[model samples]
Target: LDPFVDWLQKRKIPRGLGIVIIYILLFAFVSLAVILIIPPISKEVTQISENFPLYYEKIVNGFNAFKSNLESPENTEQVQQGLNSLGENLSATVSNVAGAIFSIFGGLFSVLLVLVLTFYFTINEEATRGFIYTFAPSNIHPYINSLHTRIQKKLGSWLRGQLILSLVIFALTFIGLTILGVPYALVLAFIAGILEIIPTIGPLIAAIPAAFFAFLQSPVMGVSVIILYIIIQELENHLIVPKIMSKSVGLNPLIVIISVLIGAKIGGVFGALFAVPVVTAISVFLRDIIEKKVEAETKLVQ
Candidate 1:
């Protein structure tokens, strides 16, 4: 045992272990950045898409009438009418832009805040890992270490893959909502993007806004949002999820549902946020133990 321990000390863990750890840290840093960065960006992007459209027609008519006056000076009545509309449109557009200038200014500060958070995670990854490692007992250090590696692998893959899935889901949702001429298409899309992070309940949470805002605007828009979410959710669950889940983490549908339900019930946004990662980590460890036991039994029989 001493000779084996001495050999372990002399030989050192493989350089590959260091590389993998670094890669995992980078992955976590970037994933956390997306969580931090995307929410604000989505808010700002949706705000631009939402509030701008509030005066979109005003902006459009302003430009159209201004152009008509320049192009066709022959008809005084048309030119005068165009000029009048242009003036009204311009007045409305100017006020809309001015009213939201404070929000635009505030947005810059939010961007900086996200950047600081992401950079902090990237640089101090080791400290964070150490903190997490302390949660497990010292007697089971090796077991906990193995579980830690497995959890990171599962989560990193899941998060990276989920990024693609969320974007696609958001894009599809946006197109459908926009086509239905939903009042706040961008806001719906942004909500869909964030909710898409959570496993089962996410899409439902996102759909509520689409339905509420749409129902307020028009019943048809409300129905459209519901149908759109259903189809998109189907596509995400059946096609995208199976295709993209790195290593096919093979979580039972029942387990996924239960985890999301319990998570949402317990901690609101945080529980939903962490539910899948916790489940995935547990699933990884269970699989590892099963595989190891089977191998040991097979070797003993031989």
Candidate 2:
């Protein structure tokens, strides 16, 4: 904040005007990005909405055909019972899916609210930091400031790295699907990109529908889609994640999985999406505290 103010002061531009100009530019960049991404996303969404029922119908028919094959006299009762259970839950499943779809729209307002708040914070960065400093004791200010800096660095890096990873996944998925002659490549790849936000299980979720769609075309194509996604996931896990995310996140796979599960249980998709960063924050703070305590203890002993 001081550096920014000094830079503006050097140029003889008023601090307030500089801040406002920076905010405006930031907002403009964000708006442009949103505008560029939204049209293709909306097109894919619309296509999915219109065609999903037909896909579901085909899936149901396939399942029924499979069930018929299990109707040997010896297996009749077991198959019938399983089918009955599935039939009973079908409505509930549809209702849950509908609710999830509706929840996606519910997050739009939250995104807008974040953008607005960010604009305010950017314009008043020094004031906000000073106001926060007022509430803490002087003795702890240095530690608090240090912690804040570390958190910001970690989180900023994490977000940027995640964004790059998602973009890479989106490009690979789209290109692979296109080359394979898969229909709805744009939509499937977009889904893959967006779901990359959730680690561990996200890629698998994105792959299911893609494979299903490919299978609808032909079995060989289905196999190709599966192989393509497997290659993508391998590259993501072994290559991209190691290069981009490992340093930024610095969390074990087990911890991430646990945090994601807990977050999903508590706040659904939004919780899961943010769980890693929240855990990262906590870990960073605790790590800093422990190191400071050890340093203080060493000094006392000396």
Candidate 3:
């Protein structure tokens, strides 16, 4: 069965088909997610139709403005303006509400999806190896296998260290918020976990909202958020980062930072989130090819 599936995928399906399939699956998942999570859009939906009266007034005013403009010559301009204003307000309201609901839990959904995909890839290690071998030259198999092993080692080491650091950060964040009596402590902690996906700027961005929301509730709570995030971020940079990323993929910290920012700029949060892994994978393959070239040159010289 495995051989048949592999053969079919390789022969019948284009090489790009795998990436396309992954994207389609991702879209389907996100679409279903949007549907399942749609109810939260208007808390009005769950708590019953609260916006009905407001919507009714808008409709009524819209019609009234249209009718008055059509019938009364002297009031034509004022009525036209009223109708236009109403239309603009309705459009703005819909946009804002849509933005708010979507922004509410944006990265959380993506983080979970990435984790799911990563876990699947990790578990099917042999299948991935076989798939890659199918595309490589027979004599190059040994070199590819060796390089893949090296990448796996890098992945395992990085993931273990990252998890430890993530837990430490999560603990500090949750404890600080709890101590300050911040509302939605659990939610904030969860947000921190999700934000930890994007390097550097993620925690900082998450912290801003925590501080802002806290400020809305109480000035003291807001101050606490600022102080807590400051300490956590500093600790992350000095202690956590060094411990987890000490002997990185040999990329400069500056390069990693730049890649993350560029990725974020390109694809928003998901881009930033996947940037490091993608960078690491590409680096490994490129180095592997370079090493093979070096060996070939040395043999020629000999």
- Per-residue lDDT tens digits for candidate 2, residues 1-302, read 33454588689987778767766886798789779876776677666666766766776677667777784765766765775576456545644654776788787765566556655765676687688889988888788777767776676677778788899999999999999999889878988998897777889999998997899778899999999999999998889988987668456667878997998799876676668768888989989889889999999999
Model 2 TM-score on a 0 to 1 scale: 0.74
User: What are the TM-scores, per candidate, against the unseen true structure?
Assistant: 0.48, 0.74, 0.51
Which residue pairs show collisions in model 2? none
lDDT winner between 1 and 2, please give it: 2
Stretches off by above 4 angstroms in model 1 are 1-149, 246-282, 297-302
Give the lDDT of residue 207 in candidate 1: 89
Encode model 3's per-residue lDDT on 32-150: one tens digit a residue.
95675344433433222344345446556656756765866757767667767865775566457556556856877777788667656644767888899999899988977887777
TM-score of model number 1: 0.48
Writing each residue's lDDT as its tens digit, candidate 1 over 160-277 gives 7778878888788888888888866766687798677666778888887578566656567678778888988888878878787746445565677789779869965456556777
For candidate 3, the per-residue lDDT at 181 reads 86
* Runs in model 2 lying further than 4 Å from the true structure: 1-37, 49-102, 246-280, 296-302
Worst lDDT window (10 residues) for model 2? 86-95
Q: Scored by CA lDDT, what does every candidate get?
A: 0.67, 0.78, 0.68
